[model samples]
Target: MTHQLTRRQFGAITTGLGATLLLAACGTSATPTSAQKASAGDKFKKASLTFAFWGNPVRNAYTDQIIKNYEKAHPTITVAQQPGEWATYWTKLSTQVAGGTAPDIIQMDQAYIAEYGGRGALADLSTIESIDTKPLKSTLDEGRLNGKLYGIPTGNNAYAVCVNKTLFEKAGVEVPDDKTWTWDDYLDTAHKLTQGSGGAFRGTNWFGADQELKIWLYQRGEDLYTKDGKLGASVDNLTEFFAFVQKLFTSGDGPTNDGYATDIAAAVEQTLFGTNKVAMCWMWSNQITAYQKANGGDCALLRPPSKAGSADKNGVYYKASMYWSISSRSKAPAQAGGLVNEFLNSTSAAALQLAERGVPANPDVLAVVKPKLSATDQLAVDYMDAIKDEITNVPPVPPKGTSTVGTVAQRHEQDVIFGRATPVAAAKAFKSEVEGLIASA
Candidate 1:
């Protein structure tokens, strides 16, 4: 299928078109321009700054509230906010970055940060003295590489299964006791849930072949790549992961390639549990709010199924839900730093960040917003609480070209699932493709 930018997406890009134009106005000189220098100085009474990000209603509401609160606190500064839907947000931002007209404060994705940061597009956040990261010590630590902090995690997320309990009960498949469930148990239950015409809305849905395979690799304490750009796990491991999904597909416990390709609407579409074809599926915990609002049904978070006999079962880790970072190229680094600090630390800001994005990164933010959470949001909070001990903010950063590799890995698995390649062939092709990307980078 061809991917074309939607009209809504085009409108969003147009809304932020001026921000990109401003990049040309601010030339690519090695040193700051006079206006840039003046921005650093107090030459103007009012300063205009643009902050760009991608989000849905919840994130927009939260961020808009934070901007209002910040404006109230700093009467002289006006923040020009630009937001687009997630599908096209990165493309717009990348265009602006290439043109040297990116926003002063950009909501950064963990995958792209290293690439942009390494290329001098992102600001060396460590040089900014105003941001007191001491309060966010743990979260900040994940953003660092080679002794420099590049991005601050806005919040952390984890991989988990979201189960439609009502469906499980209706299907007569016992909900596996949360603490004792293993991978085989989950798969068996998923198979039992599979029944009726068009698969009867039981079992799980693998929207993308890579999703379940990644979880499988995680369970086995292996990953797509090593820290130093070498192949980490064997082709056999990846092939085994693919074979498991192939079995699930054969058993009607998951979607077939045609099913996902023809029907699935990406993450947003999958969150609507009452579409009722999927009984249990993988998701990030932070998505509960959107899921609740979009589908408005009974669903609960569960620990991802573990590999029954795998040695390292504690593979689940605290993953980041993007981040906020100052551009190394920004003229007003202090102000940008101050803005990020305000967003993460202020009570009202915390209230704005709640649910729309994920759990607040700042303990203070969570405390202030705790009483204001909805029932669904509170459930997410409870899950976070239960898994808090297992959650460690490890450096989730991959090398500069990891996204390219990830894209290849995903496509390779998709092809394998569609019967375009054998599992072993897919594994070898993915490795070769990704290794070439890493080499080029």
Candidate 2:
């Protein structure tokens, strides 16, 4: 079986991250352009800054290479890289912030942007002179909160269904037309595949994810959060979503709770799709590379299901995969801002990093990197381009303490699946719990 970089594996690579802090001892604070020159006297000549991010080993390697190139270009600045897995990265960062030793630059996710920005932990990127905001004006605005730009969008990604063509062929189920397929078509296809596989396979492994709920809500002219930053989904929306998912589970068209637990607990390489036990699964477009590599099979990307013949098929949208932000407490804000500029706009860095961070947010960089991408990555880029005109406005930034909502949804979803709670009861409880979380925040 091919090895896939699962989230657990990514987070487990925590070695050597502490040594990055040692580089700070060797250099004096050098004057950086924009604000540092005006704030700090030119007494110190060298500046040492730490750029922290989380990713798989491949991302870490590319980031290290990019840092080397940046250092070679600016001899006065030395950048130490702090790499961690997603789960541990936040915990370590939170601890560092409490201790007054946060890294200068951070790789931020949209889910936590509001939480951190609201607490005044993120620096305003609008003041940075080196970062040109024109190319990705609309995308960059997704990172704004309270009339300030808190993060810079690194790249865009859309959710899609990744189909294992080999499995479809083996099961003799015709693939649905992604462009026109509705939720009813999706369920029918899934049922056909499950029955055709003689109980050896499932149709999909994505029923448990909250993203599906968001898409369903959007198709009904609602969203996960309202424009005013309140919980926007109604109980009817939640009940319908859970009921549909419950049918998929009980019908054996999707994974059972035990099967799901087993698959989800394993590495990505050992997932149902990777093992050819499922014909289709939902994933971010950016994950195609890893999923295909792990599965080692012919795969294709398709749009998610929408309501049939709905005049307003405004359900799908491109989301910022992640963002780059500067810490509010950094002593070398100018240097941090310059590094963010280099990461986003520098051709040399873009050439080296390519689409490892997802499609480049800079159109100039995208133009250069397009030809160099692998076939799978190019397909993801093309998918984003294809859907550019169809997607609706970006959803509201999640409110503070919004991260816990996923856990709550998962727990209640399992209750519905296990028949411990009716969909109506679970929906009411979920809404109350989430509203309380927001209230406490």
Worst window of 10 by summed lDDT in candidate 2: 12-21
Model 2: per-residue Cα lDDT over 196-304, one tens digit each: 8888787888535556677888888788887667899899988988888787788888887777757755677888887878889888888888889998878888888
Residue lDDT tens for model 1, 147-194: 567788777776678887778777877777665677678778788887
Cα lDDT, all candidates:
0.65, 0.75
lDDT of model 2 at residue 173?
95
Error of 1 at 35 (Å): 16
For residue 417, what is the lDDT in candidate 2? 81
Q: How many residue pairs clash in each candidate?
A: 3, 1
Once fitted onto the true fold, the runs of candidate 1 whose alpha carbons sit more than 4 angstroms away are 1-47, 195-199, 208-214, 229-231, 267-272, 292-296, 308-312, 392-395, 404-407
